[model samples]
Target: MSLEAPVVRGVELADDRTPRPVTASETVYEGLIWDVRRDTVDLGSGTVRRDFVEHTGAVAIVAVRDTPGVEGASQVALIRQYRHPIGATEWEIPAGLLDKEGEPPLAAAQRELAEEVDLTARTWNVLADFHPSPGAMSEAIRVYLARDLAEVAEADRHTREAEEAEMTAAWVDLDEAFAAVLAGRIGNATAVIGILAARGAKEAGWVTLRDPDAPWPAHPAHR
Candidate 1:
């Protein structure tokens, strides 16, 4: 199972422009996002065969509404979208992949929350970074907890439906969201991870999410 190339860092070589041979029949089969390509790498005394994969970056975020519930539960905002890839309606926190040219993670998160959920967050804190599917996809999801949210003036209507496939905004509690995740209602990994992270951040008080100027416990806290 050990298929790593036995090459060292900064291998001594005279001709840097010299190209190595790529064996055509080294790998078994190829897979999307990555190929099972094998090649015999050159070493001092021997050549070893190996295979590896490449990746591109991605990002995700949990845009928490942070509203108090009627039943003493904490509420978190979410979105319902029809994911054509999975062919099932999915509920997830606001998230998207990084720009092809590579943009900042938090900036992308903020953009996504605004574009998808119609809310822009003022305070943002990075929660975690994870490789949602490292085996094949070049997807690296950056999770963030956005707070101090205010609704945007409007959203891009064109991408809201079919292109994005987002139906409507849905808000649920942390416990309920987690329960849905457990019961297979929340199927997106980004939302699950981001919600769990947001829950932790909320507990730690790093996210004073509600409007600071508003009267606490009666405005959005007690409602």
Candidate 2:
């Protein structure tokens, strides 16, 4: 393998220097999403090794809802839930990881929307697709913007995992979501990037980014 580092955003990294490689390692992690493999890389010189990182592909759905307000009919959606990693509950847009094999990104988004909120979208716009952390994980988060909204016929949602606990969905204001993003309340990367991009498209009055090979770049059907 080439000893080159992937350039992202602005930084260009140097190649790693590992003296010796290990011959064996073990699975060091088991999580709700991904399993971690601790590998022994042969470093060519002596006996020193670093753990190699791997991950299952993950997707983050950026769900937005349409609201009819006097101030230009801005669209937004509710986002919250306990993130065990961060340990504090924050209100934002609905999003989750499709941390399973053979799962489609759009399908995961649709499911997450139905479960988190009781709504569905007739139109969908692909906002962005990128890795949240590329250094150690290979998660490609595909973010989409749902539009031309309609509610699902039967809202299948749950507050309890197996009916042991009660949970609820909260209403998220569109303006507030945007403002929260600006104020740094909305820390979810997909939500922030997708909403800001959508807003930028509206302000620019044109398509800012789209599928390069798509015939109808601005059309939602291209998503």
Candidate 3:
């Protein structure tokens, strides 16, 4: 007996802001993290100018464990840190920018895990990839699933400074974290996506997990 391929209907997505002919472009400001650029784009309807932030992209780690290898709810590592831009302390997962030249997203996530939480993981999976704000900025963030964790020694751990210096961390159950995301208690975008994605992946027996160093086409750094 022969089986035919199932027909999958493609959704008709409309994107009015497709990349148009750039008549003019220039950098407006350069900051420690990102750069602001002004561009004149022709939308076919008319020409409009706007300023946007050009980012290098970043990564977030959902450090989780489930009795090492057993199948069950896992514990997630979370952090509370001061975000000066928002003027409020927020709960989030360990994350950092892909700042280093030629550094991969997974490497950045691993570095953030060690730097922020003084922890390392033996198993890593790609959880979710998203654009924090595509309309205003070119910032794409990839969140990873990290397991088989181990704490760094006091002597080998990085000396936290700046925003990380005041950060506090805790381990929360996966289901509870998901509840927090649903309750609007977790405001961080990466954290919220990571928690919900992790739950879904867990329910699917984690068979849909991608490689840790999976190719991220949306990440400008990769481009």
For lDDT, the strongest prediction is 3
RMSD of each: 12.5, 7.8, 6.1
Candidate 1's C-alpha runs over 4 A off are 1-55, 68-73, 100-102, 155-161, 207-223
lDDT of 1 by residue, 1-223 (tens): 3678576578664323343564343555666744565556666466766654434455566766655635434677787778778798788777776644545555666777777877777777667556676445434666666667888774442266565754688778777887787787777888878777766666777653433222211111111
Model 1: how far is 15 from its true place, Å?
Answer: 34
Write down the lDDT of every candidate, Cα atoms only: 0.63, 0.59, 0.88
lDDT value, residue 86 of candidate 1: 79
Per-residue lDDT over 53-171 for candidate 3, one digit per residue giving the tens place of the 0 to 100 score: 99888899999976446466588999999998889899999999888987777778889999999999999999988899988998888989998999998899998998888999998
**lDDT (tens digit, per residue) of candidate 2 on 104-180:** 56676777677666667776666666666755654556666676666666635444463213335555555666777
lDDT assessment of candidate 1? 0.63
Task: Select the stronger candidate by lDDT from 1 and 3.
Answer: 3
Clashing pairs in model 2, backbone N/Cα/C closer than 3 A: 20-43, 21-41, 21-42, 21-43, 79-92
Q: List candidate 3 segments past 4 Å from native.
A: 1-18, 67-71
Task: Score candidate 3 by lDDT.
Answer: 0.88
What local lDDT does model 1 show for residue 57?
53
Task: Compute the lDDT of residue 11 as modeled in candidate 1.
Answer: 68
